[model samples]
Every structure is written in C-alpha cells, then in structure tokens.
Target chain A: MTDRRTIYLDNSATTQVHPEVIDTIQPYLSEKYGNPSSIYHKGREAKEAVEDARKKVADLINAEPEEIIFTGSGTEGNNMALKGIAFANKNRGKHIITTKIEHKSILNSAGWLERNGFDVTYLNVDENGTIDIEQLKKEIRSDTILVSVMFANNEVGTIQPIEEIKDILKNKNIYLHTDAVQTAGKFDLDVKELGIDLLTLSGHKMHATKGIGALYIKKGTKIEPFLHGGGQERNLRSGTENVPEIVGMGKAAEIAKKDLEKNRIHLKKLEKKLKEDIFRKIPELILNGHPEKRLPGNLNISFKYIEGESVVLMLDEKDICVSTGSACTSNSLKPSYVLTAMKKDPVFMHGSIRFSIGAFNTEEDIDTITKTLPEIIKSLRAISPLYNKD
Target chain B: MYSKKVMDHFKNPRNTGEIEDADGIGEVGNPICGDIMKITIKVKDDRIEDIKFKTFGCAAAIATSSMITEIAKGKTLEEAKEISKKDVSCALDGLPPIKEHCSNLASEGLRKAIDDYLMKKKD
Candidate 1:
C-alpha cells in the first residue's frame, strides 16, 4: 500500500474518535464492564459512570443532567423527540411544522407522523437555505403542537434562526425541537436561553464513537416513552446502557466544551483559507449555504459543468476524502433535496461537494487540498464535454 | 463503486477531446440527468480511422466513454455500430447496475456518430 497520508475532510459525516475519548472508554469496556441496572459494586460504578456521562453531555449544551437521555444514535433521538411528543400531545394538537431542508431523519420522521394521522407543513427555504419567519408564522396554527428545525443543515451547513423561531412559538404551548446533530460541538448551545423544548445530538459528529447519541428534553415537557422495558434512562428510553460508548461520548462532550472556542477559531481559519484559495483558483463556481451564518468547518461549493462523484473519486485517488451531494453517490439517483430546496440548478446540484474540517486538520492539510484540488478539477474539466473555456 | 478496470479507464481516459475536422459528431444524455457523452469520429474506407470523446459525468460515464473508444478503434463503421452497451460495460469488467446506463450512452454516442456520417454521405 502507498504510504501517502490520507486527508479526511468529511468530518460532517463522522469524525475520527479522539484519542482521549478512546482512553476514557478503555476501562469501561474491560475492568468496569457491569450492567448499570445491577445494584452490585461494579453495577454502581457503571451507573455512576453513566450518570457522569449524562452530566458532561448535559453540560456541553447547558442543560440539566436530568434532561439528558442517551440513545442509540441521532436518528433515534430525532424519532423519540418527534414521535414521543406527537403521541403524548395528540389531544393538544395533531399538527407539526418542519423545514424542507432538514436531514432525512427529521423529514422521514415527519413523514411517518403524517401517515399516522397528523397534519404536517414543510416550510420552504431561500436560496441560502434559510427558512422564512413570516411563512413560519402563517403556518403555525393553534392546533400545531411541535415545530422541528435543524440548528444547522448537514449538507449545506446553513444555521437556522432557531431563536427567532422559538420567539414565534413562545407561550403558544407549542414545543420546539432542534436537531443539533451538526451544531452540538461546533457551537455553544444554550437550551434554556434558546427556549428549545427538545434537542438532538449525535456522538460521532463530535469525535465520540457511533452508536451513541443524546437528546435534551427540558423539565416539565410531557413526552411519551420511545422504548418500554427495564426503565433505563428514567423510563423515557429503556435499554441496557452502552457503557463504553456512553462514557466516550461524555468525554468527547467534556473536551468539546473545554475547547469549543479554540476549535471554532481553528476551523474558521481553515475554512476561510480553503474557500479563498479555491475561489481564487477556480472559476464558475457557486457557494452553497449562508455566507456568514453557517458552520465553521463546512464548505459546500458547486463546480460548473463537472459531476461531483467524478471529483470525489479523483480526490480519493490522491488519498483525500470528501463527500458529495450528487445523485450518483446515493442509491435514489436523485440529487440532494437540500440543494434542490434551496432552488439550486439541477446541473450544479450534480456537482456539489462538501468539505468539512475537523480538529485533526492543520494548515498543511489545507495546503495539500488547495494544491491538489485544482489539478484534479483541471483534468476533469479538460475531458468534460460541457466545459468549454471559450 | 466501480470495478478496477473502470477506475483505470477513468483515471486515464483514451481518445479524449474533439476531432476539430471530424466527419461526424454525436452527443447523448443531458446535464440535468448528470451524464453527457460527446463523441467524434473520422471515417476512412468505411472504417473508424480516429475516434475521440469528451464526457461530463460520473466515474462510470468517463470509463465507459474511454472503453467504447478502445473497443471501436479501427473497426469498420458497420462493426462499430453493432457495439452494444454490454460490450462497453463488459470491456470495463462491468459497471454497477445504476451505472449501466452510462455504458448505454457510450454505445449510443458511437452509433449516433456513425449514423451522422452515413446521413451526411447520403446527402
């Protein structure tokens, strides 16, 4: 195998587990492997660890420890937030409102609620992928029980106006849930300040292991149990705890909270340099998502007349990893709904690529990408039938 | 998820670019659908003397374009027209099921190029 260093720029998809997190989880997997449900010494140790993890995760988002409920994944958290709230408050209302640009988890959950006898309204987004507040105000009805919006988009990294949305739903008895899976570690999330009734966060997105996620539910929020069993997670989510991964996620959250500002500064610097270099070297490209109010590490751009999958493979050949929103990369053979909702041209949608930086990246990595990407784009455009320089 | 052969051809496409003074040219697919192939050929004694292609598509599209040119090079116009999508895909070891359409575009582009030449001669 070639010894070329692999440059991973797909942090938004999932980050590499941090060394500190791995170290923190090692003891739980071996020496302290005990069921949290047991009353024995090992069990108590495991239980204490789980509770400590909950506190760390809760602290990361400025939520109370009791408000944190660990789940299998961000998908599960989203499902629990949507379905739990919907079933419990069916008497209050059967209407739900969400955006068209939400992740599949949120969109699909809304769809499931729709099929199961609920009214749903999908709000449209502007060219920058920001939802309109006036439209939201018109859509919100007395019967509307919950309004779910992602804090930041997964593909485009557009930060939604959650505070304004919260203000609109204030004291209306309508619960607001924000899928903060992308924003959990990158941005400071104040659940009390934002007035978010429910929030979802994924562990793997913030350098923790997969198969672990957390949902923050404000106190006094009435929600039904998503899983019914041995009454784990305060009976809201019932399952034997995944001790190792939970501890890892907790440690990840601790590190994230401690280094949030530093990481954000590093990521913003890298993102700015990368964008500047790419825009300077390339022509006929359009940036996707909000120019200012976006995730620091996310850089989504569409190169005209070239397909994204081709560009991705070309980059991979050089040991650089990135993601694309092109239909060719997906099984559905349809381009990214996020970009489509933004009213991007279908042609440009086919050419969209997302580069998400992480803490592990350095200036050298950015330099390598800046040096290598242009050559790949040049070669691809040379053979592209649609690209005529004249 | 292309075969190694497909990746190889994509990395080093053969007979790329346009034949400025070609006898005929063929273009297939569209940007909306995300795959487009343009082929140009020079005919001599009813045989494809020189062939070139430029593609705007995924890995499968570029590989299939290169594979078709390699398969049809020096073949008579009649033989080149008979080349099927299967021939192009099989020459590249095989494409993914979704990408089989890319091979179809390559063969169709070749046939259209040949048809263009024949149509011009009849006039």
Candidate 2:
C-alpha cells in the first residue's frame, strides 16, 4: 500500500489461479478439448483425465473417488446437498437445521425449501460467531433427516465444530452436511473422520478456476440428482463433465495438500503481524473473531469510529485491496449479515472490515498495508464528526 | 481508516460525551446496524443553547454525532429539524457509497431529538 505496487488482501472472496494450475489445464482446454462422453481416442483421453482429477480431489479430502459429484460452483453444490437430501428423504423427515450465519447460497437454499414445504431451524451464533451444539440438539426433531452446517464462515472465518456436529447427529440417523468451501484448501479435510455425509468445496476458493466445485457424498448416502441430463457423473450429475476446470480443480487440491502446512504457517504470520500493527497504530480498534479458533488468513477488525467502506476506499486509493464485507455484496449498503448475526452494535458493524490474505501475499505487503491503514483511519476520523474522543 | 479530515473529527470530535439535564435527547439507529448515537440538546426559548452526544460505534457514527451537535448549536429547533443527511454529508464533503447510511443515522438522530422536545411540551 505504501509503494506503487498494489496489495490484495481479499482472498476469502476468491483466490487467484496459481500459475501451475493454469499451466496444467492448458492442454485440456485447447489441444485436447474433446468431449469426455465421446467414444473416440481424444474423448477417452479427456474422460480419463477427468477421472484422474476426481481421484486426486477425493484423496485431498480423504473420500472415495466414486463419492464425488461435480457441480457448477459451491452454491450449486450447497443447493444439491440441501435440496437433493430434502426432496429425496421427505418421507423420512421434514426437519432441517442450519445456523443463522451460513453463506447466502446455503441460506437461500434453505429459504427455498421452506417456501416449498419443509421445516428449518436457524441456530444462533454467540458473540464470537460460534454456534452452540446444545441449542442444535434442542432444535433437532424426531423427523430431522438432515443437519447442514458450514465448515467455516467466509466473513468472520470462525471455524465451526464440524467434528462435534458429526458426533451429535451420529446416533440420530440425521445426515451431516458441511459447506467446506472456505476450509478445504486451508485446513485438513477428512470426511470420514468428520463424519460428513455430504460436503461442498469450490475450486476458486483454493486457487482453481471459478465455476467448478465438488460435492462429497459418503458411500451409501443416497441424494437425488439436483440437475438431470446425460447421467454424466454416475447418473448423480447428468451434464457432460467440465474436463478442463475439473482437472484444474484437482490440481489445485493436490497443490494445496502439498503446500498446506507451509501456506498455513505463512498466512498465520501475516495475520499476526497485521493484528499487532493495527492495534499498535490505531486507537480503539478491536479484532472481531475467535482468538485461537479462527482462520489464519482472515483478519476482521472493528475500528472504533470509522466506516469500513471509507477505510476500503482510502486503502484502495493506495492500491491496497481488502473488504468491508463480501466482494459479492460489497456494493450493498447493508452491513454484513455475519456481523449482524453476531449481535455487533450498529456503529461497530458499519466500521468493521475483513482482510483475507493468500499465497501470493508477502511480508512487505502486510507491512505496507499496516503502515498505510493507520493514516487512513486517522484521516477518516479527523473529518468523521461521529468520532468522539471526548 | 480515513483521510485527514475524517481522522481529525474522530480524534477530536466536537461537543462530545453527553449533556446531563438537557432539554431534549434523541437516540437513533440500532446495534443490528452496528452504529448507534444518542444526542442530547440543551435549549432555551426554542433556540438550541448547547449540544452533546455519546455514540457507540464506527467513524461515521462518531463523526455524524459530532457534526450534528456542531450544526445544531445556536440554531433554532426548526432550523435544526430541517437539517438533512445531505447537509451533514455536505459539511463533511461526502462519504463513501456504502457509508451513506451513517449520514442518514445522523439526520435521524437530530430529527428524533427535536421530536422528543416537541412531544414533551405537548405532554
């Protein structure tokens, strides 16, 4: 932010495609662009590539290759997991449970289910943004067939207790589904250990191209296909496979696994440095998330008397990219629902900003952003008549 | 955070804290929105004599509170009631697109204070 170079701190929105991932998928996109369903030699090659990618992605999540279902994105994967399970197992139960702080994709899907015909319970989150397991237990009904909670929140980056959720629903025969888009590449993902019957992950969140995602269904978990066509993914997904994007996603997962430990440590360093500097330079700034149980790359802060959007704009002037909220909803005048659900005060909500780091970010980038931020805050506070030091 | 203009107001906001035994008081916005402001006014002969505020949230909230008090000082209740969000924003040279609501919160707080004053007289 101090230099002429721009620093990007919004990786939670979507990561840039790693050079290796882009290179690996080039041959499939141009030279070997054959329909995976085609019986010809190139087509068979393309089909085999998709399968190889599938196996790699499965390995990344510790799931069987046969259990994976390809989809358009994380939203589609979420819809399929919720809607498919809701409609298929209707007779077994009409109750579904999710948290109030889930991504809009999951919430919207839940809304659709409620609109058509289904009972849904939205559990509340604590001040720190973690849901209570006991409340979840209270909400679970006899006919509760599905419990779909997210693995991690995109905004606050509070890692949910997915393992505990798995344990809670273990004896009840309720299916546990998690939207792990924010956690797949950044954290260890073991479906069997977590007891997730259905899991969703997006390619773009982990350095793969956008518009490609995967849904992990444990063996013997029957979910009706959300989209029907040529029965491409073992009749579970009917459209022709997205060969290039699928391969890219698989490669991204493999790369993430290979460097996950290193990346985590690096991001943790960045976040630590950021917090130390922000608190040191700014007056009355508060970090908003669980101290230990948070994503390493996510740093959500509440400035005492400044608007998050003005901060973003000020930083943007220095070519430092960050988020007042989600990039998807940055333009919206409404404050983040995640913070609102956390029960943050209105003034604090308007003043909060999220800075998500990524693989490409460097120590210098963090330093520059840290240096540039206090000045911006100081300036906004100066003109901000709302700021009352007295 | 903000430019110099914003920082000045945040660091040294005018008419800060609260005015006890005031003629009128107004509280607007809610915690759900993450910005809340309470404006207290001391008026004599329908003319605002003094103003103070206590706010709990962000720069815009603090700044808006500061600006409203500064704007309302010495002005008649009618003049202060006519103060719009645009006037506050104009005083501060405009805000970021997403922060327009902060200005609105300020206007609402000021209007609410006048309403509280008039309603008390009726009672």
Candidate 3:
C-alpha cells in the first residue's frame, strides 16, 4: 500500500504541506528557536517571525494584524470565538444563533454555551445546505449577542451566505463570526467587505502543517481570553507560540493569497472534469451540496444503494484517498450531520463520498478517480441487496 | 480497520450472486443503517448443499457474509443455525469492535434462510 502511487483526494480533511512552507519554517525549528516572549536577541528574532506570520495571516483575510489570535487548531479557534464571546458578552445577552450545518466545532461550542445557561438557536438549512435569511430574521432577538455560521461546509462543499447574513446583522448589536476553515485558501475571505466580526482559519487546510490556526477578532469586540497563561496573542490565547508551525502557516497563507486565482481555476477544472466523468460513468448517483455555489475543489456524490465506507475502502486498495459520510465510517455510527441537515435521505447520507481536490491534484488524478470509482461502485452495487438493475 | 483475512474475504468473496433456484432466501439489515445482507441457500437432505450471499455494507459486513457462507455450506440446517455472529467473525480472524454488529447480519440471514426453508417445507 505504501509503495503504490498515492492519489490524495481528501484535501478538505487536510492538505499536504507545501514544500515552500517546509523550507520557510526550517530555521525557526532549529537555530532560530526562541521563546517569542523572551527579551534576548534570539527571542526578538522569534518575536519578529511570529509578528510577520501574524501579518501574513491577517493579510490573507484582509484583517489588521492586531486582530489575529493564534491557537492550536481550527477547533481551538472556533472554541475561542464561540465560548470567548459567549462569556465576555454574558452581561449583554446569553443568546446565540448558528446554523445546523456548521462544523462540529461551532455546533459543539454552541452546545457547551447552552449547557452553561446561554440560549442557542440552531437555524435549519435548505436542501442545497444554505441557511435561510428569512428564518434568521425571525430568530433574531434583542438579547442575541452573536450569530456564528460557517463560511462553507466541509463535508458537502456548500458555501453559505455569509455576506447576506452579515447584511442582516449589520445594524443589530449581534456580532457575526464565520468559521472559514474550509474557505481560507480556496476563496476570497474579505472580512472587512463581508462585515464579519470574527473568523476562524486552520493552517493544514491551506497546505500548511497542522497544529496551528488563527482567529481574526475585529477591534473592540468583547471576547474573553481562551487561556490565562503568559500573555501571548494579545492575551486572547496565552501560551508559548508554536513558532515553526506559525511561520509555515504564514508562508502558506501568503502563497494561498498570491495564487488564489490560478489555484481556483486549476481546482475548478479538475472538479468539473471529475464530476462530468463520474456522472457519465455511474448512474443513480446524487451529487450532494449546492451544484453551482460549492467549493471549487469539492465533489460530493452519493452512489445510491451502496454504502460509502465500502467504496472508500475499495478505492483505498487502488491507492486513492477519499472520505465518506457513511455512519459505518464514523465512531458514533451516525452519518454526516451536515448531510442530515440538508434533509438528504438516510440512504444517500450512508452512501456519500467527498472527493476534495487540492493544489497538488492534477487532471490525470481526476482521470484515475473517474476511471477507478465507477468500477468500484459497480462491484459494490452488484453485491448490494437494495440495488435492482432496470 | 480490518484483519488480513477479512480483507481477503472481502476482496474475493466466496459464493456471491443469486442462486437461480435458491430453496430458501433471507435478507437482514437495511439500506438506512448502511449494512444489509441477503443469504440464499440450497437445502437437500436436511443439510445446506450450497449457500451464497450478497451484501451492501462496509468491508466487515461483506467479509462476514462471505465467511458465513463458507462456514455453513456443508453443515446441517440445525448446525448452520448454531453458527453465531461470533463464529463468522472468528472465521475472519476478527472484525473491528465497531464493526462487530456487521457479523450479526450474516448469522441472522443464515438462520432466516433455514427458517424460510422449514416454513416452505410445511407448505
């Protein structure tokens, strides 16, 4: 399995770290290793590198450098944004609004807040996985202090209406936070233009190494600190900085911003070709997510009457990496909540496969998937008791 | 995660496809739960002459289905019914703990096939 040519299509899960990012972070891990909080020359160098990375990450999302707070991962960023705000604004209100299709980080954070006596309203999504603006209007309350939604869905690739939701919350006192973990490098994240107050980003999703993420908090936003350690990240998240991973993320963010257009085009081309080829080859398949307003690199489809985990395993044998929303693949034995929120049938949810392309994927990779997937589906469907050939 | 024997059985499933004149047919599980096993048996002289399975599931389910067919093919109807879910799993070395329920489908389908054969004998 290790010797075969690996075709990695699970980019949305996490991307392969870019070679440039690796090179940029090399010195920080070795000779330049110094605590950012120290007063020595080495410390100053580390501090400068950390600030530079912050500026780069901020620039990627069009936010001020002072607004970015580094955390352990995107999950941490989301926890900081949700719990931090919920606690900081407890005097103002205890009400929070979020969509049902948000990533588990946001949803689970909101759930924690609810358990801690905050009121949370989970808005439902339409069939295409977009939240309803009219429903948001109805759900808004005077005490609603925050409305957190994801920029895009990770499982199905459905991009949400962040700008529209921002527009609705503009005049209101409620702050808006968008979890952009899936959208950071793939789309233009203009926080200012979108009127977003807070946003979450993960490094690994954008070709940087894991274990580093950033949260952009607009100036003057009331948010409690995540950690109460030695003051770092403006005391929002306190701890010794992960210098190398931060530096790598900065380089990754810079590269992502610079090559956004080219990467988008390349990814879209691969996605379109793969979608067309797979649809042509396989019948009785339903493409999940919004058909047009989806991520450029995401292609989620459900092969009817077959379980997704089986297809994933069969594809693995061919050295093709993919993820499935099937219950059998999950620890809790429940299919994807994202798909369930979209009101997809249980059968479709069990059969869903997400093939997320990346900057590294090529037309040949797409061709291999299109060629291999149909045969896998055919074999699995042949054994499926529910599949009836017409 | 599957054992090597489980992978082998999944890759080369024994006695797959429908028997044209299967004396007894049994289906367990459903598409909603993501694992379904259908077993067909040819019974003669109170023994299973042939047994086949078709499954819609993950690796464990298919492997267990294949394993049950191999375990019960030449056994008497009562002996086949005695073959438990654990027996199917043991034949395949072992299944992931999370996938232990998958083996239940194979044993249940086999027992149902026996019951179906007995029901038809009365008719």
The TM-score values for the models, in the order shown, are 0.97, 0.81, 0.98
Cα lDDT tens digits for candidate 1, A157-183: 999999999889988999999999989
Residue lDDT tens for model 3, A1-390: 122399999988888989999999999879998998999999999999999999999999999999998889999999999999999999999999999987778888988988999999999999998898899999999999999989888888888888889889988989999999989878989999999999999999999998999999999999999689888888888889999999999999999999999999999999999999999989999999998999999999998988888888899899999988522236656778888888898888888899999999888888888888888888888888788783
How well does candidate 3 score on lDDT at residue A67?
94
State the TM-score, rounded to 2 decimals, of chain A in model 3: 0.97
The per-prediction i-RMS, to one decimal, reads 1.0, 5.7, 1.2
lDDT to native, each model: 0.92, 0.84, 0.89
Which prediction has the highest DockQ against the true structure? 1
The digit string of per-residue lDDT tens for model 2 on A1-390 reads: 122377889999988898889998999989998999999999999999999889989998999999988889999999999999999899999899999989889999999999989999999999889998999989988999999888888888898998888878878989999999988768889898888899999999999999999999998986888667888998988988899999999999899988989999999999999888888888887777677799879999988666787687668777889988777776666778888888887667778889999988998898999889888777666543367553
RMSD (CA, Å), each prediction:
1.9, 5.2, 1.8
Candidate 1 per-residue lDDT, tens place, B17-62, comes to 9999999899999877888999999999999999999999899999
Model 1 RMSD, rounded to 1 decimal: 1.9
Candidate number achieving the greatest lDDT relative to the actual structure: 1
Off by over 4 Å in 3: A1-4, A326-329
Give the residue spans of candidate 1 off by over 4 A.
A1-4, A326-329
Model 3 chain A: lowest-lDDT 10 consecutive positions: A325-334
